[model samples]
Target: MSVESKKTREACCSKLKLFLASMALVFFAKAFGGAYMKSSITQIERRFDIPSSLIGVIDGSFEMGNLLVIAFVSYFGAKLHRPRLIAIGCVIMATGSYLIALPHFLQGPYKYETSVSHSISVNSSESALPCHSNHSLSEDETPDVETRTACEKAAGSSLWIYVFLGNMLRGIGETPIMPLGVSYLDDFSREENTPFYLACIHTVGILGPMFGFMLGSYLAKIYVDIGSVDLDGVTINYKDSRWVGAWWLGFIVTGTIIMLSSIPFWFLPKSLPKQGEEESQSKSTELATVAEQGNFLPEENQDHEEKEKPVTFQELAKDFVPSLRRLFKNTIFTLMILTYLVSVNGFIGMITFKPKFLEQVYGQSASKAIFLIGILNLPAVALGIITGGFVLKRFKLGVIGAARVAFAASVGSLCLLSIQVFISCDNAEVAGLTVSYQGDTQVSYNQQTLLSQCNMGCSCSMKHWDPVCAYNGMTYASPCLAGCQTSTGTGREMVFHNCTCVGEMKSPAMNMSAVLGQCPRKTDCDRIFKIYMALSVTGSFISACGGTPGYIVMLRSIQPDLKALALGMQTLIVRTLGGIPPPIYFGALIDRTCLKWGTKQCGGRGACRLYDANAFRMTFMGLITGLYLLSNMLWGNLYLKIVKRQKKLALRNQAKENGLEGESRANGHASINIDTNKDDTDKESTI
Candidate 1:
């Protein structure tokens, strides 16, 4: 090659690499924001005093946004400048992220619902009854209407709507990245190099969740009211279910990163020459002749034909229905779509509730659970994806081979998930809820169960949930339920003395005092958590190994012309049905397992305070396992179909070759007879 040509080739390669890097950055930034949002779900629920089901709706809003714009963008976006479109999406995503944090600024400092009073003076002569003082009515005075109205005005629940809308906006912005970015890469890159590039993108993208979850874990340790309130006065620890982190901060950080990601795309050209265009174009004449003769044409020729056609609004509208019809006609593609739908459903549900599951079942702190997932599980997935791609490339596996690998991974993960059912820690022993004060099991959920013979004369309200622990390791609903008449100290350090509930433990010599906060579990629970993490990491790695191969199978099975649409349709179907419903239903079902529900400041129900561990484990794991098993069955059917089709095509080709050979032999004999007749005529004329 000449010097100019070599330099031009080098420039093209450089541009391609730049585009790949930009795409990877976009992937990372978006995944970071998304994973951060998932990590903060519990915090947001607690901060807003919303139920789990409501939180699920908020989580599902992202999919709602995607449903609104994905089909249009996926179909029509190909005609536009894709890089610029992605840049516009990043701007929108940044706006959404900022909007999600808007409520934190607009609302007052987070005041968590607590039965303990902050207004009481430590030096007061009279004992301060935390729960009853708010209702202390004098004989000559009626309740003040003005005071009641003022209190009602202070509690606002409407702020969460901003979060929901913002999440939806995020979904809308994220719509183009996967479909547009992946298609762009595949179009420009060499055929053999596509898998490696995809793996690189995914591996980097996986790190986003890891860092995002890690950020969540770090943030969860800080109190939501950290700057505004005195930490010394806060009674709850990070382990408490009521703890709310500074979840808003993460949104701000992620938004900034996404905004910065948009700048590079703005500078990039609308289109770049294909990586090997020179060499490929050299054969274009021959390829065009083959296409004209009605022979099999390469994907490049089809792409060229598509590019030659003008993309107008009318043309797109006319083609939409036929395109969709043509896509669904393939049985293998249809089955593959169904399998993906099932798999995504399980994945969405599991990820949405995994942190909550760890907290409830394994007795882990929210921060710790999020941290573990980010640090351990996500990295395992990243490694598995890279390894999976390597396996595919190294072994040169085809469709059937890829399918089998995916099937085996699913089966292995399913088995690992089944093991978790028996690995749970014992339920927290709360007085009146899970057990009686006298150490007997109780199965009832009614508020009346909170009242027992141990503190029958204490006159405690069932609405108050300020729990206090006794010397015998039992936790009561409140100090009043513990039969404590007086308290020493204040805030978290406060101790309730003369607790009659302690006497029920049959130890009269022990100190009859109950402290604030629930008791921690035994050391065995910690060991159980370690083991669970190990198994969880292993299972995650195994499941992720199928990621690249599974994607390849889907890509290879569809026609090149329909690749973009197939991906978009898959996203449309999977995200709309799978993403939107899983979180809502999972949250609703998990809500049923809640043993205790918190009360909102405005007198409505709030987030769950405690859960029935065994029930939670069964519900969460069972749902995931069932979905995986169904997907496995679909994979089996798809593999069988692929094999049958390959065999049929081989037979058809053999028959065509035999027919061509017989026809060629007959033509040769006919030519010989004509030559012999011509020679006889020449001899007769000469004579």
Candidate 2:
């Protein structure tokens, strides 16, 4: 009813709201940045012609920076005006995105300049004619070639530089945003809403990468045919199909700016004491009152003078060291971090090498391989998000379980897919390219029956008919064993006027040996994306569902409010230990295999192909299986220990508290009797 009480309530609510908003921002930015950058690395490699190995270094640079600044950034952020720190973080992130867009325009100039240098050297050699030795192309040709070459090189360089610069700037921007945002959130939420709000932020955060992937895929598939044209009296070279992720980049630029603009909101302080804290303080006050009095007050008539103790800045400051310490002491915390590091390493490493793997093994184009990987990853991530969430909720599991299960599934799928890839690769090596002994002819079959189904009343038919069937009765590359009627002379069906049957029929053409020899392949891509997504989905499920159990166990072992801090500490340790030089280990393997197999750039004796296929499968499968088994044993043991400890601690504390209360009551009653006796003696003397 009092103004002060009302004011306090409103302030508490405001602080709580602000903290949630801040947390959501951080989660969104982190998840968004993570997903966006995962694909961006490949994009940069394509635009810059950078090797996959170096791409890892580039991507890792941001995390490396994070490791260096996390401690200081979080400390300063908590000490400063919460909103201002968050706003600064947003500005930094936005600037990064803007910078990312700049390289696109620069690439043109770089390309033009580089092309000019190459042209000049070639021109100098060509210009020295026999009759007119050392003579330039009549001033006219020289200027034209030089001008054209300069423009080409400049354009090329600019394109690549833009991609590199964009990624670098984005990395810089992301560094402060994550930690500061979370600290800002710490000011707002009570313990009860923390997990729910965190979940909301995570769910919303998924939108960023999902949108990015969708946008990127849409951009990738668009085909533009810039028919031949002359510009300023110069003929430009024809380009068949080139991906200009211009539109998608524009969207990214806009989103980055918008997110940056919202940073100012974090400046408003929104913090409140949690429900649990209030309850504890109330309990203490009640106990003090009961101890001072001779008898305990009735439940309804109990004193209501307890004041809510607000958390002070000084108290918040002490959180950093203790939070870190708890994580260090907890065994489960260490395990989760190790699991995550290994999972990320395997996922990222394999994907990075995928293009090379496909190119070498399947003889696919580099761009095509990269594009396929990107497309496949989308579904994998999407499905992982959805399914992982479901699993977490359904099984009452946490992030750890989802992660373990997903990783295990991914490893298994990778093993099978690897086997298929290997078989196909071997077939290519042993059978070699099938030389055409005779002209290949075409064959056509019943459209309705061959297709086997119709969609929405739309009839399915082959656009181009292949008439040729192998003498062994197989038709088409996919292999159909349908009976066919051949025209009398050509052994062709009479479905059409025997165009090839009237004369010498072309010898039946088929790659039967190669066809049978090839393996049925499975890929962790979008078309096959569901499979990979299952892994991510399962992993995320563990993160979400497994989070609660992990928290509960840790809570019993340590303290409450320390879970997030525990997670941070775990991150530092896990990265230090489990993340120990996987790249180095894998790099050594690649080099050793490259030398042993004698594999050269893109080709050689299939060493990269052989090693990559076998290594990726084995590593993922072995680690996943091992991680799951170890996690089960570890979690199981910890769970039992926690239960036993909890029971023992609970019973002991209850008995001790009861004994103390009984002694306090007896002493209070004696004092009350003494006071009564003194009062009666004084009254009698006055009488």
Candidate 3:
């Protein structure tokens, strides 16, 4: 090859590598942002003073954004400069990230519902009086709440809209990266190297979530309004449902990374020579051919017909419906999407609320729950993906083989998940919610039950959930409800004495003093939590092991021309129907388990502070298991169809081979007769 041609090929090779790197970086950025949003779901719910169901809608907004643009982008983007489009998408994603964090700057300090005023604390002599006084702690805040302007209240309630819009923008920005980038790589890359490139990118994507959850765990330990709010007055810790973390900070960090990921795309060309194309050619004649085509770009590689004429939106639009019809007509593709639809419903719902589940069911702090998922569960997922790739490569799995592996993983994971339903911690022994003031276990919540004669004189406000733990290993809704008249200490460390409720517990030897915050769960509950984590990690790993083969099935099932559009359609359908609805419905059902809800300043029920553990576990795990069961059944049907189709194909090929063999045998006999006749003619001439 000429020096110039060699240089061109070398430069093209380097640029392709750059594209692969950029793709991985973008994948990591988007995954980080998406996972971070899930990690901070509870924090957002509390910060916005919204229920799980409403927050769910906000979480689903990202998918909604993708639904608006994915089909169009996936179909038309392939015809344009794909790298530039991806760059533009990363920019949009960054904007959304910044927008999600905007609410924190716009809003005032977060004010949690508290019965004890930080200003006076327990320093006042009158506050230090015995339980006989009918002083209400809520009385001090009534005038402020009543005097609040309508506009101010509306402004605070509507701040969550910013978060929703921001998340939607993130969804829209993420639409093109997967479909366009993957198809683009598969277009220019050597066929054998494509899977390896994709595996690398996906590995980065999984790692992104790991880092995101770790970032969330670290940030959750910090106060939400860190620079603005004083720590002295903040009584709630990360374990408290009312505690809002610095959820906004991680968005800014991930956004900046996404923005940086876009920079290399602008420098990359629209296309490159297929990898190893030049290296495979070696003749002097081929070198001449390479020299002649040195300036040629591979933009026309994806379609020869497109080389004759440029593809346009109008042309593509006419074919979109027909393309979709072709895609759905393929039974394997259709069933695969259906199966994925059900599975995604379970997966999205499970991941979205998992942190909350760990907190409410296991009595773990938000930080600790997020930390565990990042450190343990996500690593298992990463390892599973690696192992799955190894299995596929090792076994040389075809479509049917891949299907079997996915089905087995699905079944194994489902079994593990079902066990989680039965393995649960008991509901906390909180007075009035799970247990009565007299220490009897009952799922009762009433004024009479909460207002027993012990603390009837204190006239505690039932509106707020200011929990205090008693000495008998039980918790009260609040200190006043515990019938603790006098208190010592300050802020979160404050202690209450002469608690009639603690005296009335089943344990006669228990003291009558109460301290701040809810009581810890029993020692056995801690052991149960560890077991739950172990099971959960195993399930995640088993399910993730099918990731690579499942993706291969997606690629192999579709026609070459339709791959990009089919992927876009799959994402649109799965994300819209699967991603959008799961969280909303799961949130709505989980809302039913709420024991005590946070009270807003405007007299509305805010986010839930406590939930019935057994109900939460059942509702969360039941929905996931049901969805996964449906997925496995569909997969079984899909697997059967694949086997039958392969059998029919094998029979047809075998018949064709037999016919060809018979034709060859007849021709061989005719050739032998001709040769024998020629030898006979030679012998006659010699005689």
Q: How do the predictions measure up, each by TM-score?
A: 0.89, 0.55, 0.89
Mind sharing the TM-score for model 3? Answer: 0.89
lDDT of 3 by residue, 475-566 (tens): 89887788886777666667778887677766643568887788899899999999989999999999998887788777766656667787
Clashing pairs in 3: none
Tens digit of per-residue lDDT, candidate 1, span 270-328: 55556765432322232132222211111223444322444579987798787677667
The weakest ten consecutive residues by lDDT in model 3 span: 291-300
Give a tens-digit lDDT track for model 2, residues 264-376. 46556423343323222223322232222221111122243355365466776676675554334444445445555555455444544544455434444334554454455
lDDT of each: 0.78, 0.38, 0.79
Q: What is the C-alpha RMSD of each candidate to the true structure, in Å?
A: 9.3, 16.5, 9.7
Residue 623 CA displacement from its true place in model 2, Å = 6.3
Q: How high is the lDDT of residue 574 in model 1? A: 93
- Candidate 2 regions exceeding 4 Å error are 1-11, 109-172, 175-188, 222-258, 273-327, 330-336, 347-567, 573-648, 651-687
